[model samples]
Target: MAVPVVTGRHARLVRVTHALTTLCFLALVITGAEIIISHPRFYWGEVGNVNTPSLFDIPIPASRPWVNTGYGFVMPDQNGWSRSLHFQMAWLLVFTAFIYGTWGLRTGHFQRIASYYNTAQRRTYLLVIFALMPFMIWTGLAMSPAIVGTFPFLVTLLGGHQSARTLHFFTTLALLLFIAGHVVMVIRTGFRSNVRAITVGGDTQA
Candidate 1:
């Protein structure tokens, strides 16, 4: 049987959404790493007393002489602009995810992506998406004292900010893994075909 192809306006929209999301994720990864390492300490294990630099080597912005980023019980100082950037990136991510998720549901992106897969494949796809993505965003937010403080119940649910930080790290790791798997799947599904679909509406224009 001939293989099905992605074509037309919908495919173009999907491609654009994918591109934007990819960029957002990459930016967040870099900024998030810098934010996490600003203190040179971690909630999990001994991150050690090492001085870790920002991921992009970009200097933290100048912001009010740098205050301590209050992570519940732990407060780290001289984080420079890492805090601001982190919060900015967090907002951007949340917005991007909201738009992408809404579009996905409205456009049937999820269904179309999984329609070709078997039950097992579909399960993995949904799990990575529904379970992992939401968890990452949630845990990331929970790390903020302001957020946790506002919703005291979050501290209980997350077992404190320290625990939230730990969960955030793992969630980021999971996102990375999901991105890798997604890229691989895209390639396997026919890179050229997919690219065309995304760029020019399937291969119709090709």
Candidate 2:
């Protein structure tokens, strides 16, 4: 059987989506890391304060470490900016993902991509797109006070805000792992050819 080539339209759409997603995801990851590092602890329940015992401590710089008189390392509080940019990028991700998903489904783009890959790869892609992404989004919203106020059930469904926060952290780790694997696979398959195909709708041989 002959290998199928990605159509021009599909390639263009994939390229655009990939660029948008990469930009948004990178911003989110950097900001998210800063936000998490500031706190450096995970807790469970709707209420978690510094005084309260944490479920797990990450051993990173605690927020407001400069407050301590003898603290060596000094890091300014970036939570305000990080939190703002995180939400902004998150919304961008949501919008781009929605468009990519809708277009892929309507035009059978996913089917074509799946047909090009092995069963394991196809399954992994499906799981990431359908399961992990949605769960991550849900957990993120559950951690938001504004979102929780509008939809109390979100936090309830996740057990608590802190639980949601913990889950979001783990989900982020999972996504990083997925991205690493994806990049490795792309390089192994044929980096230049694949890049050309997606970037400029160039033809590729199987």
Estimate the TM-score of every prediction: 0.67, 0.87
**Taking the tens digit of each residue's C-alpha lDDT, what string does model 1 give over 23-114?**
77787787676665554345532122224322222233322224233333333343456567666766776776787778778767777658
lDDT of each: 0.62, 0.81
* Tens-digit per-residue lDDT, 28-51, candidate 2: 999998898677778887777677
Which ranges in model 2 have alpha carbons more than 4 Å from their true place? 1-10, 66-72, 204-206
RMSD of 2: 3.7
* Candidate that would win on TM-score: 2
Pairs of residues at least 3 apart in sequence or in different chains that clash in candidate 1: 197-202
Local distance difference test, candidate 1: 0.62
